[model samples]
Target: MTSKNNPKAFPLNLPEGDAELLLDELQTRLREGRRLFAEVGQILAEIESRGVRDLYGYNSIAAFYEHVARVPRAEAQRVTGRALALNSRRARDGTTIDPVAPLTGESASTGALAEAGIDRIVTVMKRLPDHLDADERLEAEKGLVELAGVARPRDVTMAGTDLLARHDPDGKPKDDPEPKRQRSEFWLRQKRTGRWDMRGNLDPETGARLNALLVPRAYPAPGEVADDRAPAERRGDAFAEIVDLAEAGPDIPAPRQTAERVTEEPQPAQPSEEPASRPKPTQMPPQGRQSPYRGSGEGVQESAATERSRNVAHLRPPRWWARLSRPRSGNAAQPHKPLTA
Candidate 1:
């Protein structure tokens, strides 16, 4: 009898080694399943099933590869093509098609499948048919979103969305200018297509030089500080200024002027008006019966003093009772009548 702790002369290498061996034997003995052959058979079959004809694109083949064979859509495409190519080469006398390579070709690591996976995906995204149903769009968009995982879609293409967003009102990402990159502010805007519309961002030195070249022409000399303009406006104005400067180079001759052009165009001045001729006459109606104040000197003095007294009484403040009165509470204020002279 073996010692209690002694290892077996022919011990199983690992706990699962027997299981792995069993699985290998089982795989070797098993006949290929109908399901595996079914999908492949359908691909070769001349007659399309009810909706199978609808699925004519390589995409359907891809989906079949993914769902049935447990491979990615991209790998499935490559494998399917390889399988077809291999099948095409054999004598046409009803020879059995090679099945193993097509399925197993996908066994290679996914990282090795395509040099420019992101690029191909972006191309597909751009070309997605606008007429596709909403469901189809969602499915296609899902694939695109996945592609953007490895590389940002915006980096790959910017023309459509970027251009439209700049010109179209609603397409702009926000009312404010797009966020600037940290290294140096470059112009960037989002497109409807979800790619970045990037104009070159100058380095700090280049930006300063460009700005210095642009400022006087684009922005009037007022403000005189870089901080005054919004980055968007500054960029826009700067572009306009650059075009103008390049178009109107330093050596271009100044616009010529003529005396005719310079002469302040004068209009005939308006004529002055003449004073009108008029007649003069004077008459008086005796006020208050040719007052005694005017006729006799002593009476005149007395009369003037009486009038002064009346005028002083009229000009004085409110009467005794009136002086003590105030308005009732909460009355709406009203305008007062003018005092009689």
Candidate 2:
């Protein structure tokens, strides 16, 4: 069998054509290919119905297709699976069982939807809640099939997802009466090198709280240099800051104060048996001779010296009377004149 636009049928020196004509031919060929693929799926479904094991000595239709079609195992399995999903099944009694997504199957058979778009539609149909009635499932499938006709496969998938959400808003049913228990674990260890290692397996609630606290602190520091720290390092630094803040809080207790004890009492001061020696008086300079210690000033140094002598004279006991009372040794001691500067 050969196609009208088969490359093998054309000459090597075929003439070039207008760009628009070339594009039109390409689109036509692509549509023909899609139709042929749909036909292939139908044939595979018929082969499965007849019993592949008896016909080809293979355990499964996918295995038989892989060997006969010279295709990869995964690809063969995908095609066989899609074929089974889009085709109706016969019960033991020969009663017809409709395909999961009958509308989607119909669209796929006509080559109006791509295989991926058909798969998306079938998935949405299968995921619809069992509580939903047949009519609701049919309506959802119909909507997705229509969306798949005009949109790309990805857009079809999105539409199918939305359809499933609208039909089954609660998601999977919870049969158990008791709520699930949330579990969390944390471990911390200090290495010999003085660095700490921390690990945690937090439940949803605790993880959310930790994430909220760390996200703000983990942001790169604002400066000319970009922050080059790894994410784990940033989080570690943030945790250390949190510890410091907690330690400095007012709730932390103050350290205890200790008092020193005295071992013995102090003794009272006692007078010495011998009196303290008195300081000797300084000798005065001779009245006629100028003192060598004097500065350039004529009378300033003399006046200062005189003031010192006067102060010393007041301190001296009245020696003139004592001298008179004592006997005159060599000559009668002249009445001692009062000391003068």
Candidate 3:
């Protein structure tokens, strides 16, 4: 088309007109790029069908695109994947036929769909369960593609997600938030100062599981009176109990035994020339000797003992050490004098 007739050409010396014209040109270029991108999928499909190594001496079609065409491996792979979905083909048995992405393929080639839109439609279509018959799959693909042609990519993705959920609502992922198998992390380390610092993140379900185990144990027992422990202290006690339970359980690993140093066994010692001397047993004291201060006669202690007892017996308290040790209770009671050290 001539420059004056071409709607894409921006007119010089007209700033407002140029802005509008530039925008239109950009939009047109984008549509044209999308159309060409869709066509490239077809070419990639043909390249994939024929062994790339045999035809072009490249190990794979992706290698050919990366090395020769300068296309990134990821983009090349995406193109090949989309192409396989678009192009209808017979299986190795030649009896079963693959369903072609009719709605997506046509819309993409006609520039009705952008890259994101096409991706959304393809994702929804592929996510449909295999148990669904061909008619069901076709209907889903048609609905998604129609949405993609008009809607923004974000809206298209949301719609795709909803469609997948509707089709197989009962089906769950392989790792569907199971408490036991789900990933969780915990880190507890003792610092040099003997204080423990713990930090970790856990999935919501995992956190719930931990709360279930700890909350009940942290609270005081029924009918108990003194339950004024702080929250942190209770949690600490609960954690200690958990560790005790773990140690008591059979699953805990045995402590590692340290290796002993290797050395030659000691030789037996020879017998001494002379026999060892035996200790002599003590003889009983003379039965005739009377015990000291026993009032059995022959011991000189009765006079001094009687004199010493008479001196200190009056100083003893009524309750022995009660005056020195007993706590003062009522107003009527006398204060106890402090005892000398």
Give each model a TM-score: 0.25, 0.45, 0.44
- Summarize candidate 2's per-residue lDDT along 1-341 as a digit string, tens digits: 76677456344333576677667777677667777887788788777777787777899889988998899999999888888788886644677767787777777766677888877877777788888888887787787888888888899878877777786787887687787776898887656564555688999988998888878766775657677777776776666545444443445443322231132243444468757343344554432222232135624644554554444433333332343355555756674333221
lDDT of candidate 2 vs native?
0.68
Model 1 lDDT per residue over 196-256, tens place: 4557766888888877776653443243343454546555545643544343343434334
- Per-model clash counts, in order, read 5, 0, 0
Span of ten consecutive residues with least summed lDDT in model 3: 285-294
Which parts of model 1 have CA positions greater than 4 angstroms off?
1-24, 29-71, 88-226, 230-232, 244-341
Task: Order the candidate numbers by TM-score, best to worst.
Answer: 2, 3, 1
Candidate with top lDDT is: 2
What C-alpha lDDT, on a 0 to 100 scale, does residue 98 get in candidate 1?
43
- Residue 309, candidate 3: Cα error in Å is 80
Ranking by lDDT: 2, 3, 1
Cα distance off (Å), candidate 1, residue 262:
38
> In model 1, what are the clashing residue pairs, if there are any?
154-195, 161-191, 161-192, 162-191, 293-300
Model 2 segments beyond 4 Å from truth?
1-17, 173-341
Best by TM-score: 2
